[model samples]
Target chain A: GAGVSQSPSNKVTEKGKDVELRCDPISGHTALYWYRQRLGQGLEFLIYFQGNSAPDKSGLPSDRFSAERTGESVSTLTIQRTQQEDSAVYLCASSFFRGVQETQYFGPGTRLLVL
Target chain B: DQQVKQNSPSLSVQEGRISILNCDYTNSMFDYFLWYKKYPAEGPTFLISISSIKDKNEDGRFTVFLNKSAKHLSLHIVPSQPGDSAVYFCAASARVFGNEKLTFGTGTRLTIIP
Candidate 1:
């Protein structure tokens, strides 16, 4: 089976520009998640969607960050007015069922660099 | 606050030797833990996971040991192969309703010297 996939494996944007990262989850996955990984730092939760609706947007660092998922497949993480702090790998993951121990499959990630 | 922590930034081991990676968490509510392996420019692949009910879980040459009292867990790879060289991340989460939010560690880069 094909695993989760992400597009634009790498992106370089100037400060103040907006960038959108895309994620394609596996078929039948009902839950989708977005996370950010800064250099020398851990993964930070961004937003999560279940069946096309996001229930937890608390992790969004600021109002400039947003994400949307269509049904259970593709998702997009948009960062508005990019800053140097946003230069990092944006990861996407999906799980079959939403639970405390559901196994998650991850995408290759989009590495964004703000210049 | 950073809940999950991986103190060591990198580790090196000889081929066929054992590689140990440590992870610690401060969140007492988290009961599920997972370990992921990532290659350069690739997404993290699920390696193994342990629930709060169990103290240890093993898969092939990879073993994950958890100590609830200490809120610590470690992954051990025996007879490590060159293919196992990659960044290892430890993540934990507690489920609420159907959505579970995960907190990850800084990750440890493992290099196997063949």
Candidate 2:
């Protein structure tokens, strides 16, 4: 079976520009999550989706950051008016519908550099 | 305040030796703990996990030990191999049920010298 995949392995954009990152979860995975990894830091939770229920946006840093997942397949994270501080690796993960304790499989991640 | 802490930024061990990585958390409500291994340019992969009910869990050469009283946990890799060299992260969640939040500690880079 194929693993989770992300597009645009590397993205370099000017500050204040908007960028969108995409994620494709593994087949049959019903839980998806997004996280940010800043340099020299641990993974920070961003957002999560479970099936058709309302997505968990509690971890989103600001209103400028938003994500939408269509059904249980793919998700897109959009950052509006990006700042230099937003530069980091964006990771997406998926797991079986067994709840938070279930093991999650991660994608390679998309590295965003705000110049 | 950082909920989870990995005081050691790095560790070095000789190949075929035992390697120990430690982590501590301030939140007493956490019930599940996990360890992840990551390489440069890649996302973290789940290594092993332990629930609050169990003090220790082992998988092949990897073992995770949890001390509830001390609010601490450690991952032990016996006979460390060069391929195990990477950043190891410790994470904890308050609940094992639905919609639980995971708090992660700063990773510890492990270097295995052959």
Candidate 3:
């Protein structure tokens, strides 16, 4: 089975431009997540989508960051007016469902560099 | 405040030796803990996990020990291999409304010298 996957392995953009990153979760996975990792830092939670329920956007750092997941499949994270601070690796993950012990499968992240 | 903390930024061990990595948490509500391994230019891969109900869980040469009272956990890899060299991340989560959002600690870069 194919694991979770993301597009545009590397993206370089102007600080004021907007960028959209895409993620394709594994088949049958109902739980998808977006995270950010800065240099020498840990993974920061961004947003999560669980099935058809309302997505959890509490982890989103600012109003400029937003995500949308259609049903239980693909998800897109859009950053408006990107800043240099937003440069980092954007990782995507998916699991069967949000359970007490569910394991998440990750993708090869998309590295975004804001100039 | 960081809910999960990996005090050590890096660790180096000789191949065939035991490697132990530690993690601490400030939130007692975290009922599940997990460890993940990541290589350069790649996303993290889930290694092992332990539930609050158990003190220890082992798989192959990997063992995760949790001390609920002290709010600490550790991952031990026996007979470490060069292939095991990577950044290890400790993550925790509190199940709220079936949520699986995780709080991760700054990763520990492990270098296995052969």
Candidate 4:
């Protein structure tokens, strides 16, 4: 089966620019998550979307970070006014969301560089 | 503050030897723990997990042990192979709080030397 996929494996953007990262979750998956890993750091949760429920944006660092998922399919994470601190690998994950402890499958991720 | 912590940044183990990665959490609310492995240029893949109800859970060469009182957990790989060389991340979630989002520890890079 095809796994989660992300676009633009690598992106180089200037400071103050905006970048959009896309994620295609596995078919039938109802839960999608966005995370970012900074250099020498762990993966940080950014946002989460489950089915038609309201998205969880508590983990988003700032207002510049936002994500949208239509139904249970594709999702896009947008970072407005990118900054040097935002340079990281943006990762996407999806799960079946069976109301239990479900394993999250991840994508290859998009490495963003802000200069 | 980091809710989960992987003190060791890296570890090297001889092939066919036991490899142990440790993790600690500051949030007692966390009741579900998971381990993930990742290679270069890739995202993490689910490895193994242990629920707070159980002290240990084993699957093939991988075993996860939890110490709820200590707020600690460990992933043990027996007879480590070269293919096991990669970054291992420990994550925790608090289902009781109705939060499925995971809190991850800084990964531990494992190097299996053949």
Say which prediction, candidate 1 or candidate 3, comes out ahead on TM-score: 3
For model 3, residues A1-115, the per-residue Cα lDDT tens digits are 4888999899999999999999999989988889999877899999888874545888899999988888679899999999999999999999887355698889999999999
Leading candidate by DockQ: 3
Q: Write the per-residue lDDT of candidate 3 for residues B1-114, one digit (tens) a residue.
A: 999999999999999999999999999889989999999999999999999999999999999999999999999999899999999999998886357888999999999999
| Model 2 chain B: worst 10 consecutive residues (lDDT sum) | B94-103
Per-chain TM-score of chain B, candidate 2? 0.96
What is the per-residue lDDT of model 2 for residues B1-114, given as tens digits with 9 covering 90 to 100?
Answer: 899999999999999999999999999989999999999998899999999999999999999999999999999999899999999999988653346557899999999999
Interface C-alpha RMSD, model 1: 0.9
Q: What is the DockQ of each candidate?
A: 0.83, 0.77, 0.88, 0.85
Candidate 3 CAPRI classification by DockQ:
high
Q: State the lDDT of candidate 4 residue by residue for A8-87, as single tens digits.
A: 99999999999999999999989888989999999999888897463578889999988888867999999999999999
Off by over 4 Å in 3: none
Show the lowest summed lDDT stretch of 10 residues, model 4 chain B. B93-102
RMSD of each: 1.4, 1.4, 1.1, 1.0
Task: Write one digit per residue (lDDT tens) for candidate 4, span B1-114.
Answer: 999999999999999999999999999889889999999999999999888899999999999999888999999999899999999999998877454788899999999999
> Where is model 2 more than 4 Å wrong at Cα?
none
TM-score, per-candidate, Cα-based: 0.95, 0.96, 0.97, 0.97
TM-score of chain B of each: 0.96, 0.96, 0.98, 0.97
The candidate 1 chain A region of ten consecutive residues with least summed lDDT is A95-104
Each predicted model: what fraction of the native A–B Cα contacts (within 8 Å) does it retain? Answer: 0.86, 0.74, 0.86, 0.81
